[model samples]
Target: MIEHTVKAFDADIGQLRGLISQMGGLAEDAIAQAMLALQRVDRDHADRVRADDKAIDAIEAEVERLAVRIIALRAPMANDLREVVAALKIAGVVERIGDYAKNIAKRVPLIESEQRIEPVSTLPAMARMASEMVRDALDAFAARDADAAVRVCESDSALDDFYDSIFRTLVTYMVENPKTISQVAHLLFVAKNLERIGDHATNVAEMVYFAATGTQMAERERSARSL
Candidate 1:
């Protein structure tokens, strides 16, 4: 009976991890599709991205249910408890990331410009970096890899640099082309969304590191110092 209980508990944890993986994949795809829609100024594609956010949100709800069940029934302790709690927190973060992507997608139709501005061209790279961080953070969580999580945290700096450059360029463009300010402002919000996605990804990495090592990530302290 004890052996059977142990196996069941492990299976429950496995299922939770699987759900997180699925949710992460959907969130990552949302970011990618949002960027693609932005790049092409495709309102239809952007609408699809916005619609897809519901799927991610549904999975997050499922994860929450499963995680609560595991904690209540198995009464997980130590590493197991940390892992369950991390899943709950990470699911919330991933869902927020999906919302950020949806926010970016919603801006697509609002942006009115005859041609893609110079700053608009630079956003895709930033989005790509943010998406990669989300992917790597999930991978780290799955593998219980604290080092990999730390690496994910480190990558956020580059994403920040991308946002900074795009922000400067957009401000300069707005100053030079006063008429385009309305359109360019949407792009600024898009850049800000991507930057927030990066931050959420880093938050997931921090939770993963804590789950894997039972300690908060040192990078978080360093980041606080810098701020």
Candidate 2:
């Protein structure tokens, strides 16, 4: 009976991890599709991303329900508890990432059929970095490697730098070409959303680190408790 119970417990945890992985993959796709939609000015692709948000929302609800049930019944300890807690943290980040996807989707209609600004370089780079961060963070969680998690978390710096550069460049565009301010402003929001997505991925990496090491490696995660 104890053996069966242990199997059941492991199964439940596996299910939760599976849900996290599913949501993470969806978020990655949403961001990638959103970027493609932007590059191609494809309204249909943007609509697809907006539609996928509902599915991501459903996954989050399921993840939370399972996590809560496991906590209530199994009362996992040590590594198990850390894993569940990390799963919960990741669920929230994945949902926020979906939200960013939706935000970018909203801009598709506004920008489609309009003339794009020159040097649309940094946004794509930022999206690629953010997407990779999400994937790497999930990988670190699955592997339970604190060092890998730390590396993933540290990667956000490049995304932030790219975001800031885009911001400055866009502001300059708006100032120089006052007539393009409206369009440039929309792109600014997209860049900001992508940057926020990176932040969420970093948060997941930190959670994974805590789960693996039981000690906070980043000041941002540690300072989070005081708040």
Candidate 3:
């Protein structure tokens, strides 16, 4: 009976990990499609991405249910408890990442055909950075590497700077070319979506830090803020 219980617990963790990977793949594809839609002004691709968002949302709900069940039924302790807790938090970030992708898809149609603003120069790079961060955070969780997760959190500052730079450039475009206001505004929202995606990655990294080391990076952030 003890052996059976151990096996079942392990199996639950494995299943949760598999679900995390599947959701990650879906998110990656959604971001890719969003970028393609932007660059090519492909409304069809954007629409498809938007349509697929429901599946990601459903998966998130399912993961949450499973995680809750594992906690209640198995009464996981120690590392098992940490793993289940991390799963719940990571699932929320994954869901938000999907929402960001949907936001990008929604923006594609608004700016489909217009004189592209210079603010766009920063967006692709930001999207790439965010996607990379998400992938790295997942890898960190898989390996339970606290250091790698810290790196992901530290990397978020660069993305923040990128977002600020784009914001300034977009405002400049709107000020200089009132005619391009609508197009530049849409670009701003797209950039915001990408920035939010970076935030989601940072959230994942934070969860990983806690899961692996039982330490909250927020303490450091709070100290810095107080200072």
In TM-score terms, which candidate is top? Answer: 1
lDDT of 1: 0.93
Q: How many residue pairs clash (N, CA or C atoms closer than 3 angstroms) in each of the candidate models, in the order given?
A: 0, 0, 0
TM per candidate: 0.96, 0.93, 0.93
Per-residue C-alpha lDDT of model 2 across residues 62-181, encoded as one tens digit per residue = 999999999999989998999998998799889999999889988978864356677455678889999999999998888888998889877888889989989999999889988787
Superposed Cα RMSD, model 2: 2.1
Alpha-carbon local distance difference test for all models: 0.93, 0.88, 0.86
Q: In candidate 1, what residue range of length 10 has the lowest lDDT sum?
A: 112-121
Q: Give candidate 2 misplaced runs (Cα > 4 Å).
A: 218-227
For candidate 3, list the clashing residue pairs, or say none.
Answer: none
Better model by lDDT: candidate 1 vs candidate 3: 1
Which stretches of candidate 1 lie above 4 Å from their native place?
222-227
Model 2: which ten-residue window has the lowest total lDDT?
112-121
Question: Candidate 1 vs candidate 2: which has greater lDDT?
Answer: 1
| Residue 53, candidate 3: alpha-carbon lDDT | 90
lDDT of residue 3 for candidate 1: 96
